[model samples]
Target: MAMVCEGLVVDLRKLEELSCLEGRGMASHYYPPCPEADRTFGLIDHTDPGILTVLVQDNIGGLQVKSLRDECWVDVKPIPGALVVNVGDLL
Candidate 1:
């Protein structure tokens, strides 16, 4: 899930089109950046809108979420079997 967010940002760097992003390269198609708005990086430094985002990592993790107002990343500490679910919208 983290990589998906990072990939979107990276894709924005390569091509400005969000629609061009292929879900085949992603495990979760539900984590598209700016799903509604036709914009790139519009979701910068903000919390996720999804109720629960399931992330997949290859040994090392690759997700980075930040505070929108304060402008800082919320560092995730190492914890065994930790499934951090950032709640935003209603479940």
Candidate 2:
């Protein structure tokens, strides 16, 4: 994950000081089967407060991202054994 973050920072042409970042944290989410899935959200839309977020999603698809340009909800399809990297607000 550290390598991924470093690569992203480099690709963005951002400051290279992020390579020295040492803080680490993790979280796991579980959503039960809901018959009325449309009426409720598994997770609310929000941005990570840290510099980056690496997500590992299950086969169940519910993740969405709000488009900054159009304010539309975009579905994030899950890929097996893949990680989704997101740039957080702090970056």
In order, candidate lDDTs are 0.46, 0.71
38, model 2: CA deviation in Å? Answer: 2.3
Pick out the ten consecutive residues of candidate 2 with the lowest summed lDDT: 11-20
- TM-score of every prediction relative to native: 0.32, 0.64
* Model 2 Cα RMSD, 1 decimal: 4.0
Write candidate 1's Cα lDDT for 36-86 as tens digits: 443543235555554345554332333567767897876555354566555
Displacement of residue 79 (Cα, Å) in model 2 is 1.6
**Clash count in backbone of candidate 1:** 0
Candidate 1 deviant stretches above 4 angstroms: 1-46, 56-59, 67-70
RMSD of each: 16.5, 4.0
Give the lowest summed-lDDT range of ten residues in model 1. 15-24
For residues 1-91, could you state the per-residue lDDT of candidate 2 as single tens digits? 4465567566443444555356667787767668887787455667789877877777876779988899999988888568888887776
